[model samples]
Target: MKMDGETEQLHVVLFPFMAHGHMIPTLDMARLFAARGVKTTLITTPLNAPTFTTAIQKGKNTSRPPLINIQVFRFPAQEAGLPQGCENLEQALGPGVMDQFFKASAMLKEQLEQFLDKTRPDCLMAGMIFTWATDSASKFNIPRLVFHGTCYFSLCVGEILRLHQPYKNVSSDQEPVNTFLLPSLPHQIHMTRLQLSEELWSNKETDYKKRSSKVKESELESFGVIVNSFYELEPDYADFFKKDLGRRAWHIGPVSLYNRSNQEKAQRGKTSSIDQHECLKWLNSKKPDSVIYICFGSTIHLIPSQIHQVLMALEATGQEFIWVVRNEDDLGGFEQKMTGKGLIIRGWAPQMLILEHEAIGAFVTHCGWNSTLEGIAAGLPMVTWPMFAEQFYNEKLVTDILKIGIPVGAKKWTTVPSIEDVIKQNAIEKALREIMEGDAAEERRCRSKEFKNMAWKALEEGGSSYSDLSALIHELRGLSTKNHN
Candidate 1:
């Protein structure tokens, strides 16, 4: 099915959500497409362009470079009434600001259409948050696929719940209902009332619900979805999505495992904000499977009280650890006390590298899909402490379904009397000890190791994910040929 001459040049536009969690995986996906000889145009605001520039530039230096064009559009910050340079979700933390973030995202519609007209790409690969991109692709008759930066298990449960509306029959929406089984799913999946995202409770008129509606509509009508998961990782869920949903999807991930053109083998282990050698030196000193690594991803900044509880819990475990604190202010004086026993990585940490370290045994994570997958890839069990969004559901996939994660008893964040229900130090301490020293740790560790191998195999030549990606590339090339003719 190889196209001749000009038809081989399949141009694709990747429009990811502004957040790092969403955008980073999409960039990796763009690289995958580029590696397969697809011309990729990454669309983002000027402020977010730098994040992908290094990776894009690296591809060009390779012998077989994929045509990766970076397109920068001005973020409608002022027009959306957001502060200057606040182009991403991580920056807009204040109440009612996410509304403005979506508003700014919508503002990109006209500019995106103008670019679509100029570039006339064969396909548009959009992030789940950018619902408007689906329609923009339709105007030009371009094939569009929404990229979901999560596993198939989460997606299957989410879609099943959305379609069946099982929660609608619950007696009280405000109070946490007992855990109940989802009849639609084949797995013994049970969800507590509170496990649903806080946004689900919002009225339909709210920005969150309105955006959700748009995403659902796009999911139903678009070409398909490109998920950051591999078929072997969740075979049942992946099969369900393909067979039941009746939508085309390609599971071409653990995309993090893909070699970045800029990150040479020697430089792959480096953290963004820390010196690589110095961090590696400390890790080298520790014994195998003796250290616990803790991080809560990029967006969810822990409050001072939550930070204190976590610090105390790590100390209670009495094991060597590395903790990533976003803001130094959150730790205050705690870093001074834990000097020899614990290492505090202020700002960014080399998460994937740390997880891969021989010294690292377990992870206490927020259950963000990227972090979860990274931990799995490293063959490490987890202490799940989900903060918000689909994280709670992800927590279930790890703790209950996979049986490789210990929960800290955090059901959901309560805001009635100021963000209450923070998991106390005792629960955190129990979870830490279970994963770091308890008997169950061995069982969890073995399960994690199995998935780690599967993740790697999926990316190798002739694997499920690799073949799926090739199929997707061929389909896009066909589209390009048809359009040219």
Candidate 2:
């Protein structure tokens, strides 16, 4: 791709799904691309753009001029019968209105195609949920890569379970009663039917199943997958995804590490409810490795009963902690009771900053990939309490393979969790003690520290992730050259 006797720069377009979890990493990935001198454009909705503004501006000032661009398309919230500002999944997928969010997402396809036609980018990296993107990229002969927003372990586990149907042999969905091993993986991963989604086990074809099938098909048809993991993080599963599955894939993360500064870390995803300095000051007041940081990510809000149980557990353990909650209405002045002992962030917390703090020793997490990786990067052992989605799969990676986490014994899976899904105070306290107390806790911390070192090395100049990013950019340039000729 030579222009005026010099090689033309590659232009890459990133289209992330409108969820905080999905968009955050994709935004980091955009910065990674731009840092490598690739012209990058991030396609997002108007409302979603604000979440990314700070990070994007930081990239522009840090990097060469015009390295990144923002392309916006109007979200059809009204047509989808959603609230006017309901552009993101956090707002749109409420209760029975999930279909409306999907409908609105589908409406953006035509606009995206128009942008593709105008920009004619060399590569398109889109979120996995946007199945129609494969065809859109094909129309313009651009290379399309799917970003699944998870580790290779989960994907391998998911694909094998989907293909093998080993759960069928079980007579019941009970946890230990009908536990099964995922066959032919790098490790002997155990699972129960209760941990998996109903769509995976059920024979009935539902809307969710149909959508998943389309997404899987699109993944296979795309150029490759861009994973938010590094090779050292999950070597066996990474090998399995590429060699065994024969899928084209690249691992170029701990993407959260892209934010090298404290300011960037504080402003990574959304505005923090508590001031960054205030959070740091409180953490500094605690002794080293004394505070447990608890958060369930943006999507999963605990029910009142579940919240009460967690509070009871935290209180009973007498552990100093920082808990990020969706609402404080359920608290009923519990914050006052634990004034010096606890900090309850009402909305978003500066997770990356909090994780890296020296005073923080353990994490009580929902096992979301983003939080999981952040915890691993910070060398903090976790109390894994998986609620839904691929969180259970990630919990297995943490507890079984890594041996750096203690599961809180969450059994059921549901989007709208009920009383049955609530883990009692006793269970929560037990797991917390397991990760924060004995000689076993020290061993987990040692292992977690080793991973933290590996994560750092993976992003260095000649390291796995750095090399992978360079290789991807080189490949995209090759494609551009081929097309130009």
Candidate 3:
């Protein structure tokens, strides 16, 4: 843990799931360890290493960027289910494969063993899909931690709830609509019937429990967990994870916040994504807390109608705002028509900065874990429009339970998708206006202020988040020492 004591840098190996969602956050975490003068090697499939390294290189525009000196190492993956040139874990999980998850993990374990034998690292940090990573850490006699991409509150609850058999399968009379308020927290969480209505053997059910839980159990039985969150914002939930769950958990986020202060990262050559300066220029012109930032997390698919309606609603509201429409096809002529009131960025965004901006008012988010946490850190009220996955659960927390935000347009629980589902621009306009004005707006803003204070406190010098991170490093160091002895 002492930077001064090292002869060189301590070597740490990182392996993230192949999905972009997992890749970005885990890459962010690896960047943190690397930023601290630690020598880090990001271990992944050969096919992915080049692309990831390119992204990292792009993110670290060299000249004054606080560079994450991470080396990328690729281990060969068996090409059975994987597509050509797609040697990543995701490639392994492709069609015509059964138990591909475990098989891929087993192959990775062998690859890691060979790599570690040649290039020893002090610790191993992995994605939730790398079910054998903890074991690999143990085999190598190194410290281990799993990188989680969700809000710990959401992750903890989702993992536990997944254990229960489907309540939707039971007779309506015999079943109770499932709702439980979190203990020691100020929110209630429930499962909607739509969520319950998915097929019993669907791929959704398989991914959530079979693969995700397997990864979770592997991590739990290992060293600890490293989360991208600070403790103050979700104190009760963080406490539960550490104390009741009996896991060593560290919260060192908003990771993107540190990136803001990291002048070195700003100049990075490659990924310096989207035109940030231009984006901010547009944002600068908007009223404080007046703009609605709408974006679904990457990888979500939405109908064209859904996007068109949301666009018109923003247009009808005539509110000055920044809209991050990743897919431009749905907007039609809305961007050109509502020229003065809107700004749309084509691709990736400096999301944390936008949320933290003085002029921004609300977030129209896809309810992904990363966006949700970032939004909370910035103290912005939300307009929940869950696309799919665990997002529905997160939407429940944000709207139904937290009271800090509400759903967009229609009521979630009972509303059936009508023919007018996509064209209800007035409904979108009304929802936007309500959350941005009157008593409701003031109350939500006050709540945001309360959370902001808590977030600052969590990241302060000896705060829970800092201490947890320090502890994880210390524990890993101890493991290294014992190995030497």
Candidate 4:
């Protein structure tokens, strides 16, 4: 396949951040580009490569000429003072080796620059974390598009908070219950001071603040932003991101929709611990919209005491549920106690497949963008329990703007939450009851289903996301022609 005026096919390079949530969507984006007849190359390290191999092979088997290519780079783990196989954030987070992880990631800059100088692709699409990628692409005269791995609503909210500084007027930064209204957003979203990162409140020039400043600076200098969402999901925020923020951006997602078959859905990011057939059989036994699907995503893990609270909540509600836990040992006979009522997936579960199942009713999510979009795609109302990062912003999108989720009252932004801050069994049970029963629950479900239908429509021919993708390809082709000439 060739462009209208060009003899060569347009080639684009994708570099995703080494996190499960980021990598999954980037792979989907690669396939989306490949399906449109564009040549795509995905750049990852050795440890992370295995996670993507199956998906790449599946893409090759289906697509003609196998447009998707995988390029592996050596992760400088040892050089950066990290353990030998620590290539991803999940691994690094567990040992509190984040500084080393960032150092290792920074070490990839020279290699990436050399690769771009050699290949000189038409465009470079990279994760937002790779702040150096902007200058690297600029060095090769290639347009760089930053992928935030999130939706426009969260981005808009973040930007509004940054510029307006609404939290500055709040009484005290230490007060977990102090609520502040986010100024100048489309919605009147209120957030607690505790839900925000400490860096936002402090005047200290820490490493995180410095890195964030660079990321924002790079975004300003980059060609455009790529969002993993559909316009219909948040029309106001989508428009606000472009018109008000004045940034060149594209929404060619619910990229998860690219997985057209059960096989693809079942094996999306990481290989599932449980068999797809068995998982499906369990879901089939339950009635429609009866089970609450619970997962906190790949990064966050609840402590044993917190896990116990969740288990007690599940038992108290007597709700049929599927909970994905980091370790089965944390369950400690609770799994046996809830035997028929709960399905405890020890490691990775086929999230998309389970979410798409008819019996899966409500979602208890961390409000990670990937999980948020997946829940939206599956038409399931959520119980949002944001842990860290921009998740609180996403929770606002769900509970405030979209009104398809009920917040589980998780106030503090923490990576390793203590028992003191654990969202209690009562709060979890309350959120479950609210989302799974009553008139309000039905309304939320209806709204969620509407977004789900819109998500599907956005991927169909001539739809919003579809047209945006086509337009992006066309724009890239034009740039490619100009670059060659």
State each model's CA lDDT, in order.
0.80, 0.90, 0.65, 0.90
lDDT of each residue in 1-485, candidate 1, tens digit only = 44445533678889999988988787778878877777888898988887788655655666766667889988999899999999988888677887888888889999999999888988999888878788889999999999878888888877877777676666664544655677667678777667775566444566667777788889878999998888877788888888987768898988887753324222332226777677888999999999999898887767677777887887776878998877554676777888878888877776777888899999989889988988888889999988677787788789877888999887764322134766788999888888977577888898999998988988889989999998888788877667777
Q: Which stretches of candidate 1 lie over 4 Å from their true place?
A: 1-8, 58-66, 172-177, 202-204, 260-271, 413-419
* Stretch of 10 with least lDDT, candidate 4: 1-10
Give per-residue CA lDDT, model 2, range 1-485, as digits (tens).
55422323789999999999999999889888877778889999999998777777765565344477889899999998998899989886576678889888989999999999998999999999899999999999999999999999999998998789899989876546689889999899888988888877888988888888899999999999999988988999999999999999999999899888788898888888889999999999999999999999898878899889989999999999999998644787798999999999999999999999999999999999999999999999999989888999999999999999999988877777888888999999999888899999999999999999999999999999999998898888888989978
Clashing pairs in 3: 58-270, 58-271, 60-268, 61-268, 61-269, 64-264, 65-264, 66-264, 289-361
On a 0 to 100 scale, what is the lDDT of residue 428 in model 2?
95
Off by over 4 Å in 2: 1-8, 60-66
User: Candidates 3 and 4: which is better by TM-score?
Assistant: 4
Local error of candidate 3 at 84, Å?
Answer: 3.0
Q: Which stretches of candidate 3 lie over 4 Å from their true place?
A: 1-4, 7-9, 45-78, 85-107, 163-170, 173-188, 196-208, 261-273, 400-402, 409-427
Which candidate model has the greater lDDT, 2 or 3?
Answer: 2
Error of 3 at 219 (Å): 2.6
lDDT of 4 by residue, 76-182 (tens): 99999998888899898854499789889988999899999999899999999899999999999999999999999888877877788787878875564478887
Q: Where is the poorest 10-residue window by lDDT in model 2?
A: 1-10
Clashes of 3: 9
- Regarding TM-score, does 2 or 3 come out ahead? 2
